[model samples]
Target: MRILFFDTKTYDKESFEKQTGNYPAIEIDYLKTDLTPKTATLAKGYDAVCAFVSSDVGSDTMDALHEAGVKLVLMRCAGFNNVDLEKAAAYGIKVMRVPGYSPEAVAEHAMALALTANRRIHKAYVKVRENDFSLGGLMGMNFYQKTAGIVGTGKIGAAMAKICRGFGMKVIAYDVYQNPELADFVEYVTLDELLASSDLISLHCPLMDNTYHLINRETIAKMKDGVILVNTSRGGLVKTDDLIEGIRARKFFGVGLDVYEEETKNVFEDRSDEILEHSTTARLLSFPNVMITSHQGFFTEEALAAICKTTLDNAVAFEKGERNGNEVEERQ
Candidate 1:
């Protein structure tokens, strides 16, 4: 099986190449360019094209891939919101993804961000580096006995709940379907209650029609004063403009985001030399309370190895005409 891997980075190449030896029949060609309508023709001779979360796989790209004789679209990441699922189905392209590639890696990163932002660790580190060890504006609230509201109780949210429990926090969650395993300790609450009560709120839900901009103006208004907001999930979940307004109103003590709506053009790319004029991300960076990472919650070594193994396994299954339970289809 021949696979054209798009958006190839140094880390992605190193991880995938190390795991390719296990699947001898798979031949992969790496391309640094992202998968788009114009780049779809590059997959003419390959059976499938591997893509990341930032790749554009809309209707036009699907049409081009169909014309290029590509039958499969393998997403190396968990989120498939970027791909047009209905168009892929119409084009007879099977889409598969790595859904649960290391939930703990992301959950740990979320807690790390919360701690860093709340304690002003990033600022303190820079201050100490300049030989100035003053301890002003570094006060942080204790997490003990505070309420931690998890927006979703999926694998990653569940892991985050456990971490908060270890910190002696009261864990509350809001999900349509509650996990039975967490019923013993987690309190299932309504969205309003969670927003009004939680001292710290973490979002771990997928981006869908109903969940789009879930954390907007109204929701932010419901949150407790001096609340800490963290999002390690999809960027569209929070409305950036509304968030900025809430920040200006002094609604948040600190905000930590590993993903944001404007991250598509900047993810995994170095833009230090370029001026990001008219960028919402640049505007968000001007605030001292906001800390944004480059969507790197799943960049750990364990997560990378697991992602590589599952992606190649999915490709091998497709070649053999077997379903591996990772296939994604459009919902009716």
Candidate 2:
């Protein structure tokens, strides 16, 4: 099969090529550019295209791929937020994504973020590095008995819920599509209830129209005073400006973010030496309460292997003329 892997870098080649296997000597074309509409035209002769979380698969891009005779979209990442699912389906170009490849990887990272932020570990380490550690402004609250509101009850959310519960924290969750298994373990409540009650609100939902800016100014207003907010999900899910305002107002005690809005060419990859020049992010980083981590929730070795296996399995599945249910079916 002729395949085009877009928005790629040298780092991913080793893991992906190694897992691709030698079956039929798959003809692979690597593109440094993301799978945008302009770039999609370059996939003219390819049978399929593999895209990552940030690769553009909007309406124009999907139409371009279809026009280029691309039949399938094999997404390397589990989240299908970037894809135009309905457009792909209408164009007879099916799409599939890794469903739950590395839930533990992301969940563990969320746990780590929560722990570090709550314990002020980052601040303490920076102080120690500067040889200015006097244990001042470093006192932190214990995790035990804290109310944790977990949004989304999927594999990752459930895993995080379990961990927080194990820490003797009361777990409250809010999910549009309810999962009874997870609901049985934690208190499931309305969005307002969760926001108003939780001491720590962790986001694990995908980014879609409904979920975009889910955590905005109004919702932040409902949250408990000095609530801790943690997000390892899509960047757009939380309104960064509103979050920053919340931080300034002292509405939120601490923030542990692995993602942020306006992260098109930023997240998952590092361009550290480049000047960010984004005021919101610059201001956010200046805050003592905010802890930002480059999106590395899925950076574990196990997660990478799982992502590769699922990605290649998707290619093989398309080759066999079968459907992968995890793929996006519709959007609207």
Candidate 3:
């Protein structure tokens, strides 16, 4: 079996070799290029294709991979929003993904972003570099005794709630699927209740039909003034225009984003000196109260290892025609 890995990063190599070595019969080829229609031609004669986030898999790319005799696509990340599932199904491409590799990695990054934005840490680091030690306009709120409403109580949301509880904050959560583990201290409340009562509203849901642009005008109107919002999940979950307006009106005191809605063609790579043409992103970066990270919630060493091991395992299992739980999600 010949397995091809696209968009391979430096951190993924060690774990991939370690995991794939268990199945010595399979040969793996790793590449840093992403899987697009043009790049899909590189998968010729491969039994399976392994990919990371930001790799596009639309109908054209799927057709190309199918023509190359690739039968399976293994996604290292949880969100398959980047892949065209209907096209994959039409082309007889079975998709598998590592659903919940390490929620703690993302939940921890959400806290890091929120705290950095709330306390002006990013600005402080810049000032210290310039030898400015004054603390003018650096005031921030006390996170303790505040209320945090987590929109999705999945493993990641539950982890965030636990951290908030550790800081002496009340934790309220809302999810379409209820988690019995969080029934002790967290209340599964309505979205309206969460918006109105929460001092900090953090989103941890997947990007889906109902969740796309869930935080638009109507929902933002329900939120309290000076509410801080953080999105470490998918970028499509929040409306960029609404978020910008919320910041302008001072309704959204701060925003910590690990994902931007239009970051697919750009981010996770580099554009340091190039002029950023994305208007919404440019405006978002211009705000003093907002912070944006390049969808790096899963960049930790531990998560990278887990992602590769699971992804390679998914490919090996599929090749053996074994039942793989990672491919269990219902395709769109």
Candidate 4:
């Protein structure tokens, strides 16, 4: 089978190329262009197309891909909010994703973000680079004995809870479906309780209609003053405008975001030379306590390799006419 990969980066190409040896029957091609309605016709000769988080797989793109003879859509990342699942199902196009490709990588990155933001590591690094290492604005609080709230108790959230526990933090979590294994240690509480009590909060939930803008002005008001917020989850989980307001009111001590609302425009690309037209994104960059990463929570070597392997495995499953749990279904 011929599989085309869209919205691919150098790291994606390197990882996917290295894993091609494991699936000898499949031929892979990398395309830096993102999958959109205009570019969907490029999948004409390929049996399947592999996409990433930012690729557009809406109704028009799905229709185009179906016309192009693309039978399968393999998403290398976990979130599929960008895809039009009902449209794909209607077109008889199978969609599969790497759902648990190194949850630890994301969990660890959340911890890194939390720690970096809390201690003002970025500012300290800049100061030291200029041989001026005075600890004036570098004061930070200890995580020990502090309350850490996890918004979701999925694989990634559970991993983050474990790390917070390791730091001697009082961990509380809120999830619709709580993990039984963590019940003994991580207390499952209501969203209001979690928000009210937590000194540090991390979001690890998926983006959906119900979860969109989970953190907004009202929710921010519920959180403790001077809270440290970390989001390694989907971008839409937090409302950027509300967050900006929160920052202006001095509601947060630090904010670390690996993903943001307008991420599709600039996350994976090198657009530093161009003028940033998005005012919110530009304003976000001006805050001293805010740190934004280029949606790289899952950029670890282990995660990239796993994503490639699972992507190939999904394609192999498609060739055999077999359905796996990774297949996405329209939400009822």
Candidate 5:
């Protein structure tokens, strides 16, 4: 089973190579080029192609992969929103992903972002480096006794709820399907109620048609004044322009985003040398209260190992004509 791995980074190569020895039947070739329509032809001799969250797997790329004799698409990450599942299915290609690989890693990063942004730690660090620690605008509120609203109640959201509880916060969640494990401490509320009541709101939902732009102008207007917003999930969940308006209107005390609508162009890449003339990311960075990280919420060591193992397991399962329960289809 020859697999071509696209969008290869140093960390990705290191992680995947460390686990390849465990799957001797599967041989992988790494490529730094991203999986686009043009690069899809590189998978001509491979049985499968491994991709990450940032790789493009649209209709054209799917067609190229099918023509190149690629049978399977292995998403090393959980989200398959980038993959055109319907097109892949139409081309007789199977898709699989590593779902819930170290949920705590992302959950912890969400909390870190919230804390860092809220307390102005990034600013403080810079000021201290310049020997100008006057502490003129480092004021921050306590999270204790505050309300934390979680937008999703999956594994990562559940873990975030636990962390919020540990901070002595009143945890409320708004999800279509509630996790029963949170019944004891967490309160399930309506989306409107959560937006109006929560002092801190963290988004952890998938980006689907209904969930696309979930946080926009209307929703931002519903939030409480001086609310802290954190998003560690998919980028499309929050409308970037509306968020900028909210920031300008002083609706947010701070904003921490691991993912944003325009992140695809800058994710895992250093654009410091390039001129970002019309970049929304550059505009977002101009704000002092907005803290954006590369899409690295799931970059922990444990998560990387789990992702590699699951990707290989998916490949082995497909080769043996079996389902490992990670198979993604058009209906999924």
Candidate 6:
């Protein structure tokens, strides 16, 4: 099988190339360009096309891939919100994704962001570099006895809950389906209750219609004053404008974001010399209490290795024409 990988980076090529021995029959090619409608024809004669988080797999791209005789669409990441599933179904293309690839990596990054923001570690480092460490604005509260609200109870969210429990904090969660494994330690509550009571809120849910902009102005109003918020999930899960307003009103004590809405054209590229066109991102950066990462929550070594292996496994399963849990099918 021949697979063309889009939006290839140094780490992606390194990790995928390191695992070539696992799939000897497969020939993989990497391209630095993204998979858009104009670039979809580049996959001609390839058996499948591999994509990343920022690749555009819309209807036009799907049609182009179908015309190119590509049968499989393999996403190396967990979320599928970038792809149009109905269009893929109509084009007779099978979609597969690597879900739950080291959820601990993301959960751990979420904690890192929370800690860095709360303790102002980044600022302290800058201050100490100039020999001005007087500990004037570094008073951070303890996590013990604080209430942490988790937005999802999936593998990543559950992992975050465990970490919060270890810190001696009260853990409450809200999910459409309750995770029985976490029932003993986590108290499943309504979204309103979680929003009203949590001192710290972390989001780990998938991006869908119901979850798109889940944290908007209305929901932000419901949250407690000076609440710390962390988002390691999809960018669309939180409305950036509302978040900016919340920060302007002094609503959040600290905000850590691994993802943002307008990151597609900015995240993987080097635009440090140019001005950021997105005003919302610029405004968020202006706040001293906010910390934003370039969507590197799943950039750990273990997660990359697992993603490479699962992507190969998913491709192998698709080649066999076997039904697997990774396949995203059309709803009847």
After superposing all C-alphas onto the true structure, candidate 1 shows an RMSD in angstroms of 0.8
Residue 223 lDDT (model 2): 97
User: How many residue pairs of model 6 clash at the backbone?
Assistant: 0
List lDDT for all candidates, in order: 0.95, 0.85, 0.86, 0.93, 0.94, 0.93
Q: How does model 1 fare in lDDT?
A: 0.95
Residue 135 shift from truth in candidate 5, angstroms? 1.1
Spell out the clash pairs found in candidate 4: none
Candidate 5: stretches off by over 4 Å: none
- Which candidate ranks first by lDDT, i.e. highest? 1
**Per-residue CA lDDT of candidate 5, range 219-252, in tens?**
9999999999999999899999999999999999
Shift in Å, residue 285, candidate 1: 1.3
Between which residue pairs do clashes occur in model 6?
A: none
lDDT of 1 by residue, 119-188 (tens): 9888898889999899887888999999999999999999999999999999999999999979888999
Candidate 3 per-residue C-alpha lDDT over 1-332 given as tens digits, one digit per residue, 9 for 90 to 100? 78888887666767778777677877888898889999999999888888866888778898899899999998889988878888777777889999888899999999998898889788888888999999974678999999999999998999999988998999998998888888888988999999999999999998988999999988999999988899999999999898888889888778899997888866567877788775678899898888899898878878877887787678778877887677733444
- Cα-based RMSD of candidate 6: 1.0
The lowest-lDDT stretch of 10 consecutive residues in candidate 5 is: 323-332
Ranking 1 against 4 by TM-score, winner: 1
Better of 1 and 5 by lDDT: 1
TM-score of each: 0.99, 0.94, 0.96, 0.98, 0.99, 0.98
What TM-score does model 2 achieve against the real structure? 0.94
For model 1, the superposed segments whose C-alpha errors exceed 4 Å read: none
Q: How close is candidate 6 to the true structure, as a TM-score?
A: 0.98
Better of 4 and 5 by lDDT: 5
